[model samples]
Target: MFQETVQVLERLLRSPSQIAKHCAADEDPRALFLASLCATLLGAAAFGGVLATSRGGLQLLYSATKVPLALVITLVLVVPALHGLAASLGQPLRLSAVVSLVLAATGRAALVLLALSPVVWLALDRGIGYHSSVLLAAACYALAGLSALGLLWHGVGKSLRGAFVIACFGLVLVPTGAQTAWLLRPFIGRPAQARVPFLRHRESSFADAMYLSALSSQGIYRAPEPNSHPAPRGATNLADDAEEAP
Candidate 1:
């Protein structure tokens, strides 16, 4: 069995096109379409929960705003990773810094559009507190800008560009995962919230964690729920919500 597996692996790696074709056999176009739909529903649920209370909005605003902040934060975290990746791909170490910075700037611009536009629309539609809206708006813009930076880097950072792109995505995904964990922790019956530095306050209490999780009457939180409720006024919950291109 082991020898057979090794032989298959060797053959797969030798022909990239063959590997692609083989994997494509597992592709489910209909499932992908349905999954996309399901993703939209999930996002809407998350948005709806954020809209429930001013406190929740404030918390979400604080968190979502970190998207841009993460760009800067992750850049610091990701630079070394990107540098190494670039070098592996045959890029010059000497020029990596300039390339990384330029890419970051472009990503930031895209982030602003993704995060701020919906924030503005929501503030108008829901009559969110002005101070809250502005604060959220500013944070949203920051995220959009950073995402814009990432998109730029993805396109322009050539050698090890794939690695650079992966790193940027990691920068976005890491914080997102962290934030989701923070929000979900409280609702999962944890008794306390752990504070993370540099973004905003952590849940501070287990009960304070993701309110929507607690709010769910169903075992799981579904945006539209099976019963079907409207999503938040402005958020579609897509990456486009907070990670659009410039």
Candidate 2:
């Protein structure tokens, strides 16, 4: 019944006014089933892929309810698309085609989920903690896998393969982004080392001055500051200057 309904929906979405002319709005129960199934399968495949490959603190969340998350996305996105396909197929909602395809697609979705199962282990293998730099990969892979799964089930429906691949590419972006962010983090809080080039030179000099002044204050040197020159801005240098002068 669900499969039959989806076929009708596929026709309806493909060509809505035509379907409306012949079929009542509430005509098919199978349509709802197919819609729900597509949603479930695609959503599961999408999120499950992420759970399977992602490492880091977020892995826990991704892994825990990945299928359900996939299920939700399927309901929200995939089903509507299927409905659109049905509305335009130019045929009566055929039960056999609907059933066969839905079953095939759902089976593929399950396979994708299975394929995605390695994420947590893979992440841990890399020695990264969850919720750290690697979490984005997991999230991205999951989303990508769903699109891929949809394309696979639908047999190259409207750039599905490309879209899926693009989503997977999105995973690539996360790690690169994380590494870039990590590399650039020092500049954000930089205590001399991360300072801008010109600022780094000034900060380095200030650090050296501060270090010398501290040593002198601890009686580790004759003077951290020169008695002949005005004391530097650091408080430790002022003390050293007075001590050396007197």
Candidate 3:
């Protein structure tokens, strides 16, 4: 089982086409599914834990658990949309095939994240600022997302229609995945925060937070209004503190 799982992870990076083909046509996909799922869980958990190293403590566990949970939940929620988009784009696939393809793609992305974990840890250890670190993490996610999209593109046929299907699927995927991660925020707790929280109070959408972060990265900060209620003690603007620690 361990060897098979390792092979699945290798193929995900080295031979995405072979994985795509297996997902599409294998008579018995149980092995493939199990291997990919294991890869997804392990890879995401490792990356998540590394992300928490900046703030350290119980936050490590919180980020590790929440990251995989966010990815799995995002996968579950978006698979049906992917299926419908594929069919609408004139490339219908069996539901099981779609599931396998999506799982494999996610596993591929998770592996990319795992590969990036060390870099993230080293950057934090070197004393990168909080907002800069947030941008760095976003960049890592972009790379991992591209890896996942490559496999999905192959699964859908690597043509104009396939591109359309994947593009539409991405429209569903990016927002859903971001919001899911947003809801499960604080993967990297703030350095100044005294307590870790399992979840943060809802503030703004993921897009808004990211926008604020981008502006903040450019040295533009949103000043608090005099009449506005003060944010909670540990809570800081998404741009200023990124995600609060749990």
Candidate 4:
């Protein structure tokens, strides 16, 4: 199993275009699906290890869950949209193929994330600060996503009614992913906190989180003070620290 997995990984990483092309040619979509799924899960695990540094082992487990949840959320939202578009455009609309292609694309993104893990580890270890780390992680994810889109286009554009639908799906996918990740917050540990929580309060919108991160990074925003007492488990507290010199 290990050897076969290695071979699959090598092929996908070395020739993602070829693997994508083969998958598009109907060479066992399930194989591609499994390969991509494993790749994504493994990549997420590596990221989880990095998060373990500041967030603790419990949060590391939570971090591992992010990509899978994000993947499911994005696919659930984007797949139907793509299917409907394909149907309306009189495209063949092979649902399985589309799904496999998407998986491959995202898996490639995960591979990129794996490659980026070292850099992220360095940033986290060297103390790049909360907002900068968030921005960096977001930028890496965005780059990976764009690369994935390009791979998807290369793999399946020949069959689609142009690649316009792929772009359209991206419009929905990006926000869906961000919101989902927001809902599953604290992937990276907060400065003043220790224990991780599940299903915390939704005090702010996703836009607010990103904006505050940016503002706080620039020293323009003053986050309210944390209570002297310990925060309860499952409580959400994302307020930035005013004392830390950014």
Candidate 3 per-residue C-alpha lDDT over 91-196 given as tens digits, one digit per residue, 9 for 90 to 100: 9998999999999998888889899999999999999878888888888887888889999999989999999899888888888888888888889887788999
Q: Judged by lDDT against the true structure, how good is candidate 1?
A: 0.36
Model 2 per-residue lDDT at 213? 43
Ranking by lDDT: 3, 4, 2, 1
Residue pairs with clashing backbones, model 4: none
Q: In candidate 2, which residue ranges exceed 4 Å CA deviation?
A: 1-63, 89-107, 129-246
**Candidate 1 local lDDT, 1-246, one digit each (tens):** 445434433432243233223323444223322322232233323332333233342445443444334333434554565455545655434344333333333233432343344555566367644234433533543464344344434333434665465556556544543444343322111112243222322323222222332333223433432322233434321111121111
TM-score of 1: 0.35
lDDT of 3 at 20: 90
lDDT of 4 by residue, 15-101 (tens): 767876766676755556777889887886676556546656677776777656666667567766666665676654577767776
lDDT of each: 0.36, 0.37, 0.82, 0.66
Model 2: residue 39 alpha-carbon error in angstroms: 14
Q: State which candidate, 2 or 4, has the greater lDDT.
A: 4
Cα lDDT of model 2 overall?
0.37
TM-score attained by model 4: 0.82
| Candidate 4: regions farther than 4 A off | 1-5, 89-91, 158-161, 222-246
